[model samples]
Target: MTTDAQAGPITLADVRAALADTDPSRTNAGALRKVLGRGSYATIQKHLDAIRAERAPAPPEAPGAVPAPPAEALHAIWGAAWAQAQVMTLARMERLSAERDTALALAAAQAQDVAGLAAEIDAQAAAAQDLADSQAQALAAAQGVALEATARADRQAQELAAARAEIERITAAAAQAAALAEREATIERQTLQAALERQIDKYTDLKAVVDHLKPMAG
Candidate 1:
């Protein structure tokens, strides 16, 4: 590397040496800037143009042909135009690279957001499932309680029916006993009346016999 501080001033020789060391396809002011380290871009370009003009094949001169005066200026102008075009190309490439990096970053961020949303949806679904399970359990418990209450009501109804049947049976038995006692009292009264009538007849017969005996004795 030939820096300006070490080489005193960036010259055509310095530009030539940098261009030789660099790949021919990548030979430009920017690449030369890294090797030379201390020249303005315009100055480096001017030296590079001079080097290209020197290497370009000169047209064969006719015998006693006069050298054109404006050819040097035209060569320098064309070299500057070419250098400007290369600089524009390099700038465009750098801009495109930066844009690609930005696009990649945005894509990564979008992926992360999608992942987070997926996780949240899964959590909500799990919560809904848990809520449904709890409601089902509560309904089952309520049904069990209702069935037990119904069973108790049925048992009470059966007991009440049995008690009513027992009351009916006792009433019927008491009615039958009262009817039998009434028949026995009527029979006893009829037998007492008959004995009284027989005694009266016996008394009458005895009085008649006594009267006949008194008359005979007189």
Candidate 2:
């Protein structure tokens, strides 16, 4: 708690006055209490009530806090206050029907404005949630697409691997066939040469027979 001595040129009355300065707009009570400084909501409200009852002009509101009443709101409040005064004054003589109606209308309008602000806040929150939901959906879709692409790539890789294996098998079979053909060609050349040598020996044997027969004839 700040004492008057600790706070230079300030007093408890200053704090009360600061609390009095706050416009009683529909704001968070907790927030207002914090702004009032070193007090509870009841304390701040007591100060406000005292200021109003004592007919003192509240101090200017804190700079850059929650927006205080605008000119229009102040005017409206003044007009309503004036109407209320007139009704109170005239109540002894006659009913202030017009003033009552105007006050009721202004009150209704203010209530509608509060309601509208609440609705707008809710709408903005809903829009934010919708945007987040859409982004989440988009992320999920992207992940799904990525997963599908990965599966497709895996399938394609498998097929390519199978194709490469088939190619290797075919190339190996062709090499084996080429080697067999070369061996067969060599065997056929050796067999033909052996047959030619045998035929030459037969021809020599036939020539001996011919020589023997000629001698016998002579």
Candidate 3:
């Protein structure tokens, strides 16, 4: 247990002074008990408590001079003021301690709130990153489709060029075949005319021979 010197108002030196002095406030209760040889320790403790209460914290010096009390009540008023001062001091200390604890608790709660906010920000950032990644993937797919479309268009252009070339080649062949047919028709007509002239010459020669033989018989 804590000693009275550590917890109470009076120090060891004060105890020694009280023991040496003849005054009531300075005198030791233990020695007084021996002198009286009658009261219990509990009685002594009660008297000590009274003295302590009388010596309690003081009030503010009454703000200024106000009204003076009657001489009969002066002593009572002074004692009452001293007792009030002691009570006020203890109350103010207790109040200040309570306020300090409240401030500390509030500070701790605010720190936790800050941590929660930071975690929320981190979660949001992760979600945003996921969204950004999805967007990037979609853009890449669109670009790939555009490239494929460009390649298909190029292939179609090449096919169209080849089709035009084939059409031109077929047209040239048709023209050449038409020209050859016209030349063959002209050659057939000339051969038929030469055969007709040879037949006509043979017929004229046979008629002349028959006429000469008849005139000689007559």
Q: Is candidate 1 or candidate 2 better by lDDT?
A: 1
Q: Best by TM-score, which number?
A: 3
Q: Kindly provide the TM-score of model 1 when superposed on the true structure, using C-alpha atoms.
A: 0.44
TM-score ranking, high to low: 3, 2, 1
Candidate 1 pairs with clashing backbones: none
Better of 1 and 3 by lDDT: 1
- Enumerate residue pairs that collide in model 3: 18-26, 56-86, 57-85, 57-86, 58-85
- Clash pairs, candidate 2, are none
Report the candidate with higher TM-score, 1 versus 3: 3
Q: lDDT of candidate 2? A: 0.77
What TM-score would each prediction reach against the true structure?
Answer: 0.44, 0.44, 0.50
Residue 65 Cα positional deviation in candidate 2, in Å, after optimal superposition: 62
User: What's the CA error at residue 16 for candidate 1, in Å?
Assistant: 75
For all predictions, the C-alpha RMSD in Å is 22.2, 25.0, 22.1
Relative to the unseen true structure, what is the C-alpha lDDT of residue 155 in candidate 2, on a scale of 0 to 100? 100
Tens-digit lDDT string for candidate 1 (160-209): 88988988887888777777777776776777767777777777777788
